[model samples]
Target: MGTLFGTDGIRGRVNQYPMTPEMALRIGKTAAVFFRDKTSHKHPKIVIGRDTRLSGGMIESALVSGLCSQGADTYLADVLPTPGVAHLTTHLAADAGIVVSASHNPFYDNGIKFFNSRGFKLSDALENDMELWILDDHKKPPVIEDKAIGKIFPVSDAGMIYSNFLLNALPPDIKTRIGGMKIVLDCSNGATSTIAPNLFSRLGVEVIPLSTSPDGININDACGSQYPETLAKKVLASGSDIGFAFDGDGDRLIAVDETGNILTGDQLIAIFARFYHQHHLMENQTVVTTVMSNMGLGKALSDMQVTHLKTTVGDRYVMEQMVASGAHLGGEDSGHIIFLDAHTTGDGILAALQFLRVLVSENTVASQLANVMTVFPQILMNVTVNAKPAISDIKGLPEAITIIEKQLGDTGRVLIRYSGTQPMCRIMVEASTKTEATHFCGQLTEIIKIQIGT
Candidate 1:
């Protein structure tokens, strides 16, 4: 067997090798053993949560069985967001938390990710140990005796607890300020379908919810953050002040302004960074973003006298840098924004609330607020590859990238890297114009294809 974990977690098509019930069970057992051995608690507890996926029930049952068999009690937060699970883990003081959802992927795919006691994703070292144990026949989990066996129970108030936490994160006067503001929400028929709609309604917003009904197979079916065009149309048609689209697991968010223009995560971050700086809320006068962020965002941050720190792709790396630098804001261009003072992981609903707070407090509209930073034209291309070779080993790829970088000079930038969660290489270019960005991006894609494409 190969490594069971990826950048996010163990993910694959449902019923496939890594996503199968057997593998989920083994993962649960191995994770229980690992956590139990690491903690001083004699009987550790694990919390499991999942999105509205057809395979979620099957995977959740297997995980519960394996965890119980290993004498680890389990609490089930059924159909909750990824960030909700992370929050519940720390709230309930569980030893660990597991989320069963492949994020923004199609419904046919599933995944499992672990969060430590502190409500953060498990470190690579811990995941590696669990992976080794999963494949170790000699270390197979031994079923506990009858008296020591663990029990599983439902967390009836999980949603309420998480919702209250999110509400409290906002200013006390938020409801009064946002009252009667027409807002559209696209929940992607996944975890936030209920939570987001109810939360917004309670906050006195005129909420027009889309894709709030999840029938297992409809999650992320051309309606989530991955496809904001539908939401954009809805926002314009409904005459809403703003719109927010969340991924299947509610860890990412993409916004649609009133004019039906979709705002990239970079634009959102830039807006918030300036707001935070003006309000003296930004710690260390810095914000963190992934390498995939637009160069325009960096330029904007510099103009605002705020430092910009770039981390490797992935919210985990962004969070790591934030914690090290004491930055209160960090996120990816893919819409995974992390508000360290608010929540541990990327909570789409929480981020949306923060954005709304900024708008209400500033007494401004989405389009005007979004104009705080000028977004340069960016084009990204992904090329399938047969192998994962080091960038240095890719003949002519470096020279090609260097030439493009020098040609673009200070007005543009180029980034060529392999996707951490997929079998593809991503070539991203940002230039002064759409034509320049697209033309150069196409050239780089061809170079990558010839050097390493499948």
Candidate 2:
């Protein structure tokens, strides 16, 4: 009965608490009833998509059963990316969309996220209403008549449709420039395994794909954006122009330059912002990012005369700020970039294409393009904790953080926050040198663990 939604959605180990089949069923029924009441459609339709997790089928079946029971037609787009579900929801004009995957998490964990009819993540109010319905003890409504019961349909071409959409979204000149370009891709053995290879090959790029074979358990098994070392090695060995690594659900991207250097999400965003501004495509000449973004990105944006807005540590918050400020570009430091003019949500493949477009249009290599922003030395430490005690509640934590802030002054920054989806405290420090950042991060993490350790 606790709050079932996190920063992203309801995520947990499979067969546990909010991720259980029973919980999924209830969520589906609750969502169906809520959307039905909000819309005038006689039979509200919900499109469902999932990644290659082993539990995806189990969760999908439970959701479909519950949705149909509430007279909400369900369309299953099996094994598609999260953004694809969002796109298909709006493309099909469905009432809502559901994606069942834990994104970058391992196969042992899973999650459920919802998108409104406009392909945007549901608002907090809507999520709260659904949680209430799930917890309510009111009697269930009568079952619909046999003919009135919702039907389930299979989307046979969902992946193809999404792939084509991404292909067409690229700049027209990309086709000619990308031809004969050698590129390596690491699909994370998740949703992008099939679609990414196909799309890149059709675009006439020499595609060297890794982790395209998904056995469900292999997704994100040391090969995705979270672990770009493998991709970097491949890019160097294959002598490819660049390497693109996608997270499990294809909502995140991390790139490896030709020299085998990994590029952070902030660097990519800086590149895109500069390109968009030079081309007069940047709306309001602004970019939105989260607090977790590197300080160098802010400095780079300032140099370019583009306003930088920082939001909470989530892509949804970034998107909300982008929409509010009329900014066409926003993303997180974790590689979740949103191109408002292109797609409703972050699409790894699409973002990669945009990155490629920058390279092609500028007639530059990945290393040179990534140099658009100079990243300061950053150190992040995740300390496991028994509970999420507020930093103010922890004795001496506030004074210690304040001292570090004053010592670093304007040359660096410090961010201490608890993970929204996990039981840990993240300590991030940026300084002029790696040694300073690492030392300070180690000190902060030890303090946190002593105060809140299990």
Listed in order, each prediction's TM-score against the native is: 0.96, 0.98
RMSD of each: 1.7, 1.4
Tell me the number of clashing residue pairs for each predicted model.
Answer: 0, 0
Model 2 lowest lDDT segment of ten = 135-144
Off by over 4 Å in 1: 450-454
Tens-digit lDDT track for model 2 on 1-454?
A: 1377888888989999889999898888887888899789999989999999899999989989889998999999999999999999998999999999999999999999999999999777778878788878794545777888789999999999898889889878787789899999999999999999999999899999999999989999998999999999999999999999999999999999999999989999999999999999996999999999999999999999999999988788889898899999999878999999998888899999999889999999999988789999999999889988778898888888899889899999999998777777899999999999999899888888898976
In terms of TM-score, how similar is model 2 to the real structure? 0.98
Q: Give the clash count for model 2.
A: 0
User: What lDDT does model 1 reach?
Assistant: 0.91
- Clashing pairs for model 2 are none
Best candidate (score: TM-score): 2
Collision count of model 1: 0
* Residue pairs with backbone overlap in model 1: none
**Candidate 1 C-alpha lDDT tens digits along 19-128:** 89998888888888888997887778899999999999999999888888888899999999999999999999999999999999899999999999999997778778
| Model 2 alpha-carbon miss at residue 163, Å | 0.7
